[model samples]
Target chain A: MGSLEYRCLKATGVYNVLSEALVEIRDVNFAYGHRPILKGMNLTFPKNKVIAIMGGSGCGKTTLLRLIGGSIKPTSGYVKIGGQIIHELDRAGLYAMRRKMGMLFQFGALFTDMSVYDNVAFQMREHTNLPEEIIHDLVMMKLHAVGLRGTHDLLPAELSGGMARRVALARTVALDPMLILYDEPFAGLDPISLTVVGNLIKRLNDALGATSIVVTHDVQESLKIVDYLYFVADGVIITEGTPDEIKASNKPFVQQFINGEMDGPVPFHYPGGDYQQDLKLKSIERVKNNKRKVTERYFGLDRRQKKK
Target chain B: MMAALTKNFVGLGRRVMNSLWRIGIGARFLSLILLNSGISFSRFHLTVKELFFSGVMSLIIILVAGMFVGMVLGLQGYETLKRYGSESALGSLVALSLVRELGPVLAALLFASRAGSAMTAEIGLMKATEQISAMEMMAINPIARVVAPRFWAGVFAVPLLAAMFSVMGVFGGYLVGVVLIGVDEGSFWSQMQSNVDFQHDVLNGVFKSCVFGVVVTAIALFEGYDAPPTAEGVSGATTRTVVESSLAILILDFILTALMI
Candidate 1:
């Protein structure tokens, strides 16, 4: 019974014991040119919790991570991290803030030119005046934590997909950041590797006592590890809860997403005119022409005959 | 008919506006590179690595092309001067042509195709792969760490490459004229020394190369940094770097030659 939990229970009439939020994204709106990506979104990422932002692809998940990183400013509203509005920070202030943050971009995004040891040691070498000996030990420790103690000498291209992702993970937590952002960390991994990565992420967050925002659509894996889940669709938070609450949720979007159902809120087919009407028009045109050979040719049905 | 004509005019206006907008963005990008160039100087190894890629790697093509061009100039100039019975002036003719105009322009055009396109593709692919965004997240300024070093390397490398090209061209001319064609070696050396003004011709050529270096590298870097993050976008940007750099170099050469002459 923390005081914050008691206050939350009293305010919302729900027994939600969330720790204080490390990141507070308030009424944020963002767009690329005329295409709106996120619209009027409000979310909180509690300190030291592995919070998963689950969404379909292109549903503003990565954009939310970028907003948190202050790589791009919101169109309207503020994103506050550690009580400071990120977009308002000056260059030095912003960089100082970013020092406390680590982000694992999708596909590793490891510097192709550097070896795994150099990649993991990059931030430490750049930001610290520590001796090479200390940096070497630290890099090895990070790699060991990710179960990749032996792959330090390998280039990113030399490693398998799973190995590369683990190396990237090691690199991400090298600075022992207060906040870690994972963009599709489970993407394109084998099931075994996926489980290994999920466990590593949980372990790292716990070991470092860091807040993690994992933007992913892998429902089952996310359910297995996350402290809370925020399901996003159409640029807004459609539903949010703990893993239990998310599992029991009756929200149609949540149900569709968790069950991996097609043809629900997100349609199976692209939006277009009536299929029946289109077929009818095509049939009429076919009849008017009264050319079976031409129809077959137009429809590629004559390709086999032509090949013969 | 009037509607079509109006549409054409509107499209033309739109294109003009787009070009102007891009030019403005390019100017801003150049300023950002200049402002963030402190790291490029402080960390000289990064620029040196780029110099190897964009400069040292380009030596083969520059040397071979320079030799061929000089050989052609030797043959052509010898023939023309023979008609005027001033065949001894062959050295002056080849040296003037290379030192004044052909050296900087041809070297820059080759460098644009060779190194400028590579810079664009490398940076563009980096963007497409999210390396730039990753660098930003790590509190690293990509402009300072990546682009500035590359930009400085190009600026330094281009003039040096051009000088080498001119020197190689002279050697090729000597090989063809004095050695192959039996021209008087003493007369060739004397005439070249007497006619080629170090202050006017050589310095102007170096100035032209420096300007071309700036133009080519700036265009390449700007195109890469501004490229949309996609495979198609990177390919398109690489093509635009070569095309735009070539055009900029040629136009600047004309302007510089006009001013110098």
Candidate 2:
């Protein structure tokens, strides 16, 4: 079969797989005090699909995650999870709604005082009557899924960044939430951890049949893991498609972002000089510098050296 | 200079009014947060520990401070009354002073400065780091889950501590009067017991501490809830919670004393 037919078949196969509109962000606009962050934002994640939202820093990606997760109410719009209006719910209603969703914070956000087992079992103990023995089994199963069962008794501070995120992921899935929200899941991770988390995200999505919405800055890794994608910049979503389509888009913002370039339609907001002056100064420096430094300055090649 | 001072006075008055308004708003928010926080066993345990630490653990310091305050009151009262040849009344004066004034007010002020600021900072950090948000996403109510235990704990713990302070202060006066100054212990104790009535003083002191406890915990939790979403915001919240709660405790002490007396 041709690629188009294969793609069509794959897309249809996912429709009704988990079979619900698990999360819907409709005409949402949010503000931090008087500063507007997200305006007229609209998005949807159907059940059983992994959707990645990629953007630069301060692009309102994480804010969108907070809005959908019901951590903050939008100033002028509404978010619905499982077709229920989240913002309108009373305290009890809101708490009940929140129980259906899980979140993996960018910083892992584990309770520093609790052990990994306690952290994962927190929601179960809070909202359910499950015996401690059963809770332990479920927590271990979730930990084993993330390959961190060996560290189940460790405190969050004892774990490295990667391991913390794994523990956080395990905790996020502890309740077997119908949906999961991942905020900057792969940012700052080493290549190995990135791949590990990426694969694990996919694995969890498949095994638990949980829909996921990932807010990230790692384009290549996100594209690999997500089934659908949205690209955001300057507090608004500019374009959205499958990973192949996003990569193939000729839009200047996407192009400049994906290619990691300086001279493009997206102008640099240099601290003390105009774009032309900055570009000229940078170009001369690039020519005189070593190829390694040049590549590092433009393409993130120095990351390897810094890691070593 | 006159014009500037007048303007400044008016500004200060308005600021005080605004502060009171915000405190009211904070109390409302605290209740809403508590209402939203669903009941859970672990959260209840955490709250109990927090209350015990904030309230009970500080009893020794409160008692020591109260004793010193009582001795100072007796010494000063004796000096003042000596001129009028009314030194014999020192027993009644010291008892009334401690049970009616020094005990609850000082203890509450101390609690606000110490525990109030710490609670505010803890909650502020939780907000800045999105841990509070994480709790919400996990179907946990941040206010009820976190603040209510501390609130009720303060409500219950502060009065008990204040009672301890009052008892210590009276004994402190007794130490100076009967043991140090050679006043007859029996006469001093009997006179104090007669002069200090429950309706007039002891119950009033407890009432004041209960109010003070509510105010301190409410102010700290309010500052925490209103903390800005950054590290600096947490620091600012801690400072404001401490300063404002202390001031509020003193001012409310005056009001409660006026109403009760």
Candidate 3:
């Protein structure tokens, strides 16, 4: 862990700021109807750097990613990529913004209908006038980058989960995007696959000089590659720190989450109209007169327990 | 206690309102899908083959099913009307019933059930798996890239399919009326054709089918796009798209007939 922390620190320092930051989200708020999902969220991504957004489920990490990616508009505030504002753009503008960015979905999200070659060639066919042979070679080159050469005819369903994700990653970067957004890249993967994906992400970022924003629940793997880190909860960014700083963060919620504790600042049970029932149960349990039955029923203690 | 119950009721109402509002957002997203689809027309040539395939190929099934439907309707109508000794009215009955109303409505409903459900499920799975978001990140317009092909495919396909259905249905009626029921083949077709104006009723039916196609495709795509990121959510969206789109088609057909007639 110490060596890994030192390496990450050294890597963070080596990230070139000259490549230009592709996306900068500032003080954004999002809501699913009346329920707030993100509150005054702010983030910036320098080009060619791999940043990780880590949080528990429903923490608006994905929401932040969507806002930057221009899939969803922020209810308040704005996201700017270079000089252009995302929310001010129409569909074409958004599409233009999106073209510069590539995203890797958790399950790979490869079109099950299309083969690997077609999947990688989707954007090329859509946006470019490249000849068929050139497109084919480009797809093969991308597949080769992900170590998936010669599997161009295979459908998404035919591949293993890890392989499918790799294919998706290959397809994503096939456009040679300037930015990459990875939503839970390491989630639901075995250790070997996780490292493979992690290494691939790092390699893609290095090779393409593309900025990456990874949203993940896998803290350790995410920390291994991410230069900058954002830890979010309750629809708001609670803290932003370097990987080592996040590991050393004493913030209560972050601590509780990282340590995998059941009881902490984050409540397990929802506080609802059941407060009366809770109070009633507490009162009943507090009554010493009910000890014999309470011990036998609630605690599941046998009659020999009193003797002990 | 009554006040608490009232508050709970109010809360429930608010929650319901919130849900409805979210659905409206989904609808708006679908409209955005339409706008994006319109933008996709700039790249229409590439999609022309798919449009032709999804349009021309799917017509076969509708044709076969529609012929049987017309035959069945003719057979059943003939049996019922013959008892009243008004067998001559069969031409008007079948023509009015099919060309004016049942032909387009039934075809739209069938198409919605089969193609609409599959589209909803496919896109719902994509949404649940965050593929839509992935497309957005790659600066690929999912509406342009995914939904537009389907939208235009359905838009162009449904009407053609409806026309084929009408033709096959008339032929099926001819087969039953002339061959099985001993009505002269030429006279049966002539009577049916003479009574039904292709421009007025059939064209109107085609128009309504076009509307139905849009409605079905919109509903399916909207439900799929708005689905929660869960297996159950995907399934629910698929089911809702099929049910709601079918119902919407029926309702629209009735309204259109009432207005057009």
Best candidate according to DockQ: 1
The residue-by-residue lDDT of candidate 2 on B34-60, one tens digit each, is 565454234577767877778877877
Ranking by DockQ: 1, 2, 3
Query: How do the residues B90-192 of candidate 3 rate in per-residue lDDT, one tens digit apiece?
Result: 6666776777777778878777777777778888888776677666666667777788777787777778778788778877876787678976556566666
Query: Which numbered prediction scores highest in TM-score against the true structure?
Result: 1
lDDT at A43 for candidate 2?
79
State the displacement of the C-alpha of residue B259, model 3, in Å, after optimal TM-score superposition: 4.2
Give me the candidate number with maximum lDDT: 1
The worst-scoring run of ten residues by lDDT in candidate 3 chain B lies at: B46-55
Candidate 2 has a TM-score of: 0.82
* Full-model lDDT, candidate 2: 0.83
- Measured against the true structure, the TM-scores of the candidates, in listed sequence, are 0.93, 0.82, 0.77
Q: What is the DockQ of the complex in model 1?
A: 0.79
Quote the lDDT for A1 in model 3. 24
Better of 2 and 3 by TM-score: 2
> What number of clashing residue pairs does each candidate have, in the order they appear?
0, 0, 3
Off by over 4 Å in 2: A1-21, A24-42, A71-80, A85-91, A150-153, A248-251, A270-308, B1-21, B30-47, B78-90
Tens digit per residue, CA lDDT, model 1, B153-240: 9999888988988888888888889899988998998999999999999999999999999989999999999999988899999999
Ranking by TM-score: 1, 2, 3
* Over 4 Å off, model 1: A1-7, A10-18, A33-36, A277-283, A289-308
DockQ scores of all models, one per candidate:
0.79, 0.62, 0.60
